[model samples]
Structure formats: structure tokens, C-alpha cells
Target: MASCIQIEGLLQSYIDEEASVSERLLIEEHLKSCGACSERLALNRATAATLFEVWREDQLREDLTRRVMAHLPEMPPPTSVSAALRRQVVVEGQRTRRWLGAAARLMPVFTPVILIILAGLLWVAWPSYYNMGGDEVIGMVTYCDANPDATHYSQGQARRLHVRNPIMPDDHFETGEEERLMLSLAGPSHITLLGQAAVQVRAPRAIVVTRGDVFFDVFRDNRRFQVHTPDGTITALGTSFQVSASKAGTVVTVVKGEVLVDNETSFVRLHENAQTAFTATERPTVRQGIDTSPYLRTARAVRPDPDAERRFLTQFIRNATHTPAPTEQVFVVNTERRHVNALLLKWMPDPYTSGHAGYTVYVSDSAMAPVFKTTISPEIFQDKQNNMVRLEMPNDMRRHDTHVLHITVMSDQSSGPVETTFTEVAAIGEAS
Candidate 1:
């Protein structure tokens, strides 16, 4: 016999129709057998029913009255002023409006001064603050324990992007909706998927798929190696690869690397020389006889459009390869001279072949490596003529080097992953 306190815990489950059959039966049996419990349940149900009935009636009456009132003419607020005073008030209001308009125009001139003063005040009030010294900021100034000592690119010129995990159990996820999943990885690494996808931290760094397909582009210094799906699992030994998983099972074709497919019936190892397919109830099968060239051809045909793919691909390549163009620049010069207020990296045609196109942006230091990254939701793509991103320095963030940016642009349906990179340059005063 559960105590009343314990029974109360099940109340919400009961109301939500989520209680197990055994729990429901136990509750019903207890209500029938125990007089006090029965009375309490009856009273609670009756009260709920009564409240619902009353609320329904009240809402209905209010809606009817609102409809009736909507048909009636609206009356203006009553005023007691004499005709002369009313006319005077109107003239004074017009004069006030004109003054307000003049002040609004002058506000822009004063805004810069106010901002400078505030910055001065912050410096004066907190003079001891300086750039935080850590391996992240010092870059080659410190020892490279896990990374290479050789120069991958110029640290000062490249934009560093940090991409964080986008799918946590605490994160809001809707089923059947295409979501752009961004993750942080050392070096130039990215993952993008269509439909429902969730990432888990343990055991080969897994991402469980609720529905749809996913694509991963992994680079150097990354340890993550496995992707789990409903039909089968794809485990990477090393190198670059692309895999598509659905209800029909998983089709794994290596671009430049090797992977192991573990189906329930058999285990098959796929190397750079071969492609493999696996299903839930069947054994892993290798296709050694098929020509790899045709597969690549069909893949290109099924792949998202070249223009849509270039958006994300360009961002990553931009970060990975930063030989200053002889006569061209990617970012436009800032007119306001404010701290790089916003960085927008966009791609088009919904980033996919079957559905609408889209683009996403990330902020980091190493365009090739990102510590934290995510997609820009409610993003405006393709129509941005001017830089519209606004970033607040020190308040919104403190300027630090060794930070990296990785952007991944994805399509709506039947598309693949396109990744990009941008590096944040220290503002004029912060460049030491």
C-alpha cells in the first residue's frame, strides 16, 4: 500500500495519460477499496471537472461578449479641457514632437561620445585588467602539448571559431524537423545532419539518430570515431569519410579513409579500397566488384548543388587556407570602426539538393580548429549586402587570440555537409 505522499507523485502522470497500466490499475483498485482514498479521489476529480466546466463557460461568455463589443463603435478617452485649452494643447504637442524629432537626429552624434566615456570609465575604474594569460591566448608563446608546433597558418590574421555541442538532453529538439548539429573538435572538423539527431559524449563519441541521415568531415587531431544509427553503426579507424543511414540501413563509402560496420548478423571492415552496406537483420556485405568511379559519379549526382555546397565549404577552406589574396579580401572594411560587431558567413539554395537552402556561422580563433561552435538560428542568407552582425566587446566578450571559428552550411533535404571557417582579428586598441 503506497502512502498518500507517494501516491501524489503519480498524479501528474495520471493527468497526462502517461501512467503505466499497473500503476493505473493499482490507483483505481486503491480508490475502490479504501473509503478515505476513494473520497479524496472523487473530490479531486469533481473539483477538477467543476473548475474545467466553469472555466469553459467563462471563456465562452467572454468570447461572445468580446464579439458583441467588437461590433460597437470605440469611444475615445474623455477630456475635460475647454476648446481653447484643447487647441493650445494640440499646438504644444506638435511643438514637443518637433523637439523630439530634433533630439532623435542629434542622438547619433552624442552616442559615440557616451560610449567613449563609458569605455574610459571602465578602464579608469578597473585599471588592473589586462589580457588573460593562458595557453589558449598565448598560442605558440606556450608549449603545444596536444597540437603540432609547426605553423598551420598565421594566427593573427585568421578568424578563430568555437563550436559547442548543440544537442544535449536539456536542449530542445523536435522530431522530423531538419536540425543543423554543430560540435567542437580540434582542427578543421564538422558534422551536419538532416532530420532528428542527438550527440552523446561517451563510447567512441556517438550520435544517436532518431530519423534521417548525417554527414561528418573529420580532420587531424580528432579522436571521435563512431556514429550509431537505428539500422547499423559506422566506426571510423581514421581518415576522411561520408556515410548515409536510414531505415533501409546504412551505406558507407569511404572517400579517403577506412571504417568498420557492425551489423547484428556480421561485422565488415571497409577500407579506402572498398565500400560496404549493412542492415539490422542482415549481415554486413562488401561490394569489391563494383567500380568506385560510378559510385562517386552517382554520389555527385545525388549530392547537394555545387553553389549551395560552396557556402559552407568556402568558409572552412577560407580558414584552412589564408594566403592573403593579392588584390582581393573576403571581409569588407568596417565603416563605423566598432569592434568587429558581427561576422556573418552565409551559403545558399538551402544548402541541400532536395529542399530549401540555408547557411550558419560560428565564432572562433583557428579557422581550422574550433573549441566552441553552433548554427545561427533565424539567420538571413543571400540578401546581406552589408555586415549586419553586431558584437559587443568585453561586455559581450573579451578579445582573446587562439579562439577559432567553424561554420557549417546545410540544405533542407537530400543534401550533404559544407563547412567553412573565419578568424577574429584583434580590434585596433586590443592588438598588442
Candidate 2:
């Protein structure tokens, strides 16, 4: 015979049908004599049954609501409430009763027809609603180590890949020891993956680095390219950069061009030959002259065509300097001490410009009084293809102040000086 406390412990298991046969028999025998235990078991069963009944009723109500909504006809707005009230008391009441009775009689027949119509509508609209298109092959594996074990995830399934495998968006890659992989992507971007690295192609313009080191030789384009690390996100401004991740922090190295490194609290811009480090809980630290010789060697070996760079630059310039400059372009000036306050100015040359001489940037106070000026050399824009220049604020003038920049571009074919004025506002806040 089982004691009441023992039977109490086994009661739930017995009710759930998980008790051993001997234990079940023992509990059954005890329940026959123990009123309290028997009542508890009965109460538990009754509660469960009531809950199931309520759930079933709720589900039925939901189905009926959906069907009723589908069958409802559109109604026009009421006109002349006094007239409507008089009509509703007489002719409308009879019509309403007849319609309700007829609807009740036809519900069974209408259900299947309504379901079929809905299914057809869903079938017709499914693709556009979900945007389920074939995955884009953005890149192909150019190199792999001997029998290197790399896996790619697609459509919620993981598959192993060999050399020459096509990389698609949302395709995650995990490499093993002694493994080296190279990817040639659409932007003429060359990515080199070292061993023990994990990365995902989040989109055509974005890559997420989970661990290890990867080098990027991103060809300059108008697209916003980003690399997300655990510590921060690095945004490319037409640059070749490298991201290295570890348990301690993530390191970003800019070999050429520029990049913006941002964490939750602050952001810092890195130029050529610059580097920065970020940790999840700490502010980003800028470092001087990182050694990128090893990655630079790899980038040079797989360098893209010189013409591609020129085309990208030309397209960017055309887009940035369209006919009749837009009046609403706003450039925010950063007041954070760690960030460089600069404005990027670009312009298109006249139709017959053979060569550009240079540019002169003049900074003036709010009253239009000249405060600072500098002349930029044509060599700065040479081979870049893009007629763009950056006007940086002198260190002394970077304090909380409003300034105006007057830019004049000199080219051989220009009939007159090409000039534009920009307002720079120093907003007070931490850099984002």
C-alpha cells in the first residue's frame, strides 16, 4: 500500500500515463481508499478537460469570424438618418430578417467556395507578398586549401563547398585549420579568408565577421559597403580594409582610402595607413600606422583592372554632381574630439575640360569674413578619376562654431570658375 504523500507525488505521473505499471497499480489502490487523493486527481482531469473545451471553442470562433468577414458585403454610408430610421422600422426590418435567414441556410455551401477563392488569391499573390526569388550568386571561390573543410548555409540547410563554389547572400562560411580561401565578388572585391575564420555574406553590400581575420580589396563604388563585427561596424568609403576578430576585440586596418568605425557609443574615421580597435564595452581606440604589408601583397596579386576603378570613379562623380546641384544637401559637422570634421565636395568638369589645375577651399565665418584658406593640388585628384576633394577644418576652428565653405574648381576647359557654397553646422553630441 502506498502512503498518501507517496501517492501524491506519483499522482501527476499517473494522470500523465507515465508511471510504471506497479506504481500505477499502487496509486490506483490507494486512490480507491483516499478521498483527498482521488478528489485531486479528478479535479486535475476536470480542469484539463475544461481547458481543452475552451480552446476548441476559441478555435471555432476564430474560423467563424474569418468566414463571416470574407462573406460580408460592402455597405454604403447612411443617408438622412430620419428617413433611414423610418425605413428601417418598416421595409428594412423584413429585408434584414430575410437576408439573415438566407445567409444561415447557405453557410455550408458558401464555406468551400470562399475557401477556394481565398486559396486562389493566395496562390496568385504569394510570390510578391513573400518576395521569394532565387538567391543571387555574388561571388565565387577562387582558391581553397587541399581538402579544406568549408560549409555554407542556404535556405536553412548547411552544405559543404569545394573550390569554385558560388557564394550567395546569407551564405555562412566556416573554415578549418591550415585552410585558406579566396573569393572574387561582383564589385571586383577580393576577399581572402584565413584559417579558423567564420564569416557570412549578409547581403551584396554587407559582410558580417564572426571570428578570425579577413582581408578586403573593395573597388570604389556608390554602394554603401559595411563589415559588421561583434564589437562594431566598419563602413567603407571607397577603401581597401582588413578586419580581424578575436575574443578580446576587433581590429580594423585601412590600407587605402577611408573607413568609418562605429560602436554603439561613438564612431571614428580612419584614413589610409590608419588603424583602430574596438571592444564591446569600451570606446574605439585609434592606432597609428598598422602593418598591412602581408594583406597588401595579397591584394596586389588579385588587383582588379585599372579601367574598372576609373569607371566606378566616373560614375560616382556623375551621380554626385548632377545638373544643377540640389539645394537640400545637408552635411553634418562632428564635434567629437576623436572624429575628423571634414566636408566631401565633388563636382563635374565642363564638357571640354582637358585637365584640372587644382581647387581652392575658403572657410569664412557666419558674416562671410574670410578666416582660413587652402589650395589643393591637382595631383591629389590624379588617377582617382573622381573630381572630389575633402575640405577639413583646421584644428583650431573645429570648436562649436558655424562656418561657411566656398569652393572654386579650376580646369583647363572651364569658361569660368566652378564654385559652390556649403554651410557646416557643428552639432553638439557624441559621434555616431
Candidate 3:
């Protein structure tokens, strides 16, 4: 009979089906005789099953990323374009000089007149050179989900786009289910599309996304990249992010660097590993962490960089413990006594804290003396990314006067109390 310690050492190998025939027989015989060992084996089996499922899921995700990135159009080195242009210019200049030399030999008197004409021609073609510079290829379709099914609409005609097709300004690409497209853009940016995504390429440096989820791996330079959505616009200096658009709302997740989400009602900035969801009606609600498994998987497909996973894990672990509670500068709307139904307070707490012991809202008629007090439950803060607490104002307390509201966080740790205060002026039809 195998001892527990011996069985423990072989458990993983046995679960993985990596044990030899003799080892398997021994483990099986031992498991049959000992109930505790059997139970332990059963638990190991369950854990193995769970791990296998997770591994399978990861494999599938990795496969999808691989296929998508493999299809991205190949981009040549950055110096290629300028080098080709310079070669062309040199060739043209040589031809012109040769022609001018022959004419000068034939008619020395008219040579000066020909020189003036040639100079004028060069000046006339200068704008064409300027326009050619603007014609820098921004993005190319490296892979299309289904070459026949995917359609590109440009210049009032819809046609199928194949691999190596350049995506130009005003070009609209739409994909169906089971169809994905990958784009290699300037700045060495990469974008992958999934699930009925429709993206329109805009001039200069912008993309308009009408639907679906798109992942971006953008390299930051001096230029700004922008994504226009139905609910709002996302602007990034240089970052890797994912934007998902649906009927419900738009969600932006920043994997690396930061981005600014702006709509008519609100403007919010999201940092690395942060996420935010925006709706047409509501304000942007910020969240702590973003699930970057899909993006990271796709990035690995684009370029198998071992450091990418290490960096992600490192940042994730650091965020869990090191991120401080966020302080917010908020503007209070509808502060009029008659219109103020509730005092809305929004904040973000440190996720590493054990638990919150509820909060107290102190409303004072004067800065020194408190007039009203409201205590809120910790339930108001639980599992909330953007913590919002709304306390109803008493009819008597809603006077046409300026009041100071103080909020303090109650926690188990002795790191000292976290508190913030804002002054609210209650005047009819006025907000301050």
C-alpha cells in the first residue's frame, strides 16, 4: 500500500494521466483500500477537471487570437515609403537635367527660357507632393473573417475586401458572425474585430465604431487617436484598450496607458487597468479592474512577447494592494432647495480594505455647526466600482441657503479616517 505522502507526490501525475502503467495500478489499488485517500483523490479529480476546463478555454481564446492576428495585413518598415519617394524624385530630377542639357546645346539662347519654364513646372507640382504626403497609408486589412461575406463600403459602392487591402478614409468595413477582421494601422497600431463589428475609417487619425467589440493595441507617439461611438467618443494619447458597443451602452477598458471618454454630459479619464461604462442617459461610471484576457491573448498572437503576460500579472497584483482610494472632484447639479431631492455622493474605495463600516453625511448650516446627520449602510459601498450614495434631503433642511456637507469613510484599519467635504449652495434655479 502506498503511504499518503507517496500518494500525494503521485497525485498530480496520476490526475494528468502522465503516470506509468505500474504507478497507475498502485495508485488505483491504494485509493480503493483507503476512504480518506479516495476522498482526497476525488477532490484532486474535481480540481483537475476544473483546471482542464480553464485550460481549454484559454486554448480556444489563444487560437482565436492567433487566427485573427495572422490575418492582419503585413506592414513594411517605416523607412520604406520615404526611401521610395526619394528614389523617384532623384530619377525624375536626372531625367529633367538630361533633357535640359540637350536643349541647351541645341539652342543656347532659349535655354534660360526653358529653365524658367521647368522651374515653374516644379512649383506647380509642389502641391501634388504635399498631397502625396497626406496619402500615407494609415491602415490595411490583414485578415478578413470571410473574404466573401465581409463587405467594404466606399465611394457609394459595397464590395468584398480581401487580405492586403488598404483601409482608406471613409471606408466602412462590416463583419458578420464567425467573421473577424484585423487591421494594421500606422503607429504600428493593431485592431481586431469580433461579433458583428462595423468600423468606419476617418481621415487624419480617427475611427468611428458603430457596433460590436474592437480591441486596440496602439503605440503612443505625439499624435492622438480617437474612436467615435454612438454614446460618446474615446480619445487616447497612445494606449491599448477595448471598446464594446451595444444597445445597452458603451464600455471602454484600458489595458495600458490612459484614455479620455467624452460625451455631452460627462468627461471621464481612465487609467491603466481601469474600465468605464457610459450610457446616453447616465454619467460615466469608473471601475477598478478590466478583464484583459481577450486583448492580451490577441496581442500575444500579434507578437509572442513573454514580457506582456509578466507585465499584466505584475500590474494586476500591484493594483490589488497598492492602489489608493480615489479622491473625486465632482460638480453638484440641481442644488436649488426646491429641486434638490437627494445629495449624490460618488467615490472609489481602496479594494484591499477589509470592509467598510458605513458612512456618515454631515450637513451643516455653518461650517462649524452641523444641523442634520444621515448614516448610510456599508451595503451602499459593496462591490461597487463607482460608489454612489444618495441621501434624501429633509424638507426642513432644504432651505434656500448654502450648506456644507462632510463625508467620512469608516473602515477597520487604523490608517486614519478618510474624509472629504463639499459646499452646496441652495438657491432656486442656480448651481454652484
- Specify the poorest-scoring 10-residue window by lDDT in model 3: 412-421
What is the lDDT of every predicted structure here? Answer: 0.45, 0.63, 0.63
Expressed as tens digits, the lDDT of each residue in 90-198 for candidate 1 is 9999999999999999999999999999999987875121232321211111111112222112223221211211112212212134333333222333344433433
Question: Root-mean-square deviation of each candidate, in angstroms?
Answer: 36.4, 29.0, 40.7
- Candidate 2: regions farther than 4 A off: 1-135, 146-150, 298-432
Residues 99-141, candidate 3: write the lDDT tens digits.
9888768896787888999999988866321332334545556
lDDT of 2 at 178: 58
TM-score of each: 0.30, 0.40, 0.39
Candidate 2 residue lDDT tens string, 66-108: 7788989989876656776887677878999899999999999
Model 2 / residue 75 / CA error / Å: 95
Candidate 1 deviant stretches above 4 angstroms: 1-184, 194-204, 220-224, 289-432
Answer with 1 or 3, whichever has the higher TM-score. Answer: 3
> 136, model 2: CA deviation in Å?
2.2
RMSD of 2: 29.0
